[model samples]
Target: MNRLDFLKHLGLLSAGAAILPTNFSSIKQSPFTELRGGIGMFSMQGGTIGWYTTDGAIVVIDSQFPDPAHAFVEGISAFGTGPQKVLFNSHHHGDHTGGNLVFENDGYTIIAQKNVPALQRTAAQNSDNEANQAYAATTFENEFSFDAGDETINAKYYGPAHTKGDSVIWFENANIAHMGDLVFNRLYPFIDRNGGAMISGWINLLETVAAKANSETLFIFGHGKPEFGVTGSREDLLHKRDFLSHLLEYTQKGIDAGRSREEITSRTSFDEFPEHISPSNFLSLPRNLDVAWLELTNS
Candidate 1:
């Protein structure tokens, strides 16, 4: 059999289904999308949760918050009788890892980047909620891989792009990739500089991820505007990269003109980029600018 036939036999390389927020809201449940190769995504409140089931075993890529995670667990359980479960955190963010305990308490081994626990623990302590966390039981420095039958699920760190512990989860056979908070679709994203997010590094990371995906690959995003929604193609990833690049350029120009931090921060949004600046969360632009300014001036 040829490669295309082999992939077809595996139920991969097909056109994808785009998920809309309204679809989830109307159902009154966290949205569940079935992809090729037994892979799917569940969007609740935080980062999108990616899951793969093969041979009665399920491997989860990120768990949203606790409340949504609970609902997600229940919703997905109906898909199959997959007694085995494992979880992975795309980053240390609460929205991504908050629901880990749901799975952890259910006997799943929670995994993450090596830097996750420290950030997770620190965020919990800072909020005085250390007892509420579902920290990762396993951590890796570079990459981690798990093979369930012929479907290969792999995760790799691209450095402090979205956060210090950020990584991308890939469902190899299905050609589906979960970007967590890395690609925020067309909405303005939270650049967690407090958690080691660097704008320049984030730009590079998007390029790296975009290159790995072909025209057929379906990408799931962490968050999107109410109208924009998540789950898109590689072009969406490049859209974010271009936005960040323009943001850096715009900020650098302001700095070169000797604008104070406050002056730069005072600007609500970049003139040319509507993709990264949301009117409702207009304040986020200044915050990202503040960080971009600091990174450019300091480095």
Candidate 2:
């Protein structure tokens, strides 16, 4: 099989997916998309993966799942060998960190927010999948930064949003930021209220991140509606913020008017965000309204 055929076999490229041009021909061989300045994105399942490959080190933002992670590991092999590998978990969600065990076995040092290990462990234990998890050994509370050759990686935690441990990993030199599950990009997000997700806080976090980014900065989102894709600009951030803000406002109004939870969550879709409406009620608008109502009433 040819290189394109090999990538398709690995499930990186779909049957009709277009292969965009990149400076590095090696990236074309696999599913890894080179954005700029050695930074790139890989999306297959779960949260999107951001990566930076240099002569000295290979840095990864999030791991999707064991199967995809293994495919990613094999795909990046074309970049050459003997580079230090590092994986950073965006949060403790199974979809994002499920591939931790795969990376752990391959000698990658995993890092995450301070609250991640316990959250990960608890989630694993609850699901009775503890053996499959690989918790982060090194963690930070507010911020963490490290130099990898010419590139510098910075991770920041802005309190609870998608999850309490949600982090934004920025590749400074590349001007690329990985928004983890924080900005779901036109998709109805998974609001992990049990894990400390707050719609108001999520809105604030997006506004702050967007304000900090310049026009040239590129963002890689954890998830997005198929039409929007996973990578976009700061406008996408504000678009998400608008969605969350509207969700809260609408829910708060419903509570003030003494609307029943059923009445409030009865709507299957929001007129403003048609893209976020899932046909199967998988991460549906009603679920977001339910979470928003609970949050507003402090229940």
* lDDT by candidate, in order shown: 0.76, 0.81
Model 2, total clashes: 0
Clashing pairs in 2: none
| Model 1 CA RMSD to the hidden true structure, in angstroms | 9.2
lDDT of residue 154 for candidate 2 = 93
RMSD of each: 9.2, 6.2
Worst 10 residues of 1 by lDDT: 11-20
Q: What is the Å distance of residue 234 in model 1 from its true position?
A: 0.9
TM agreement with the true structure for every prediction: 0.87, 0.88
Best by lDDT: 2
**lDDT tens readout by residue for model 2, 210-274:** 98899999999886665677899999999889999999988888888999999999977788877
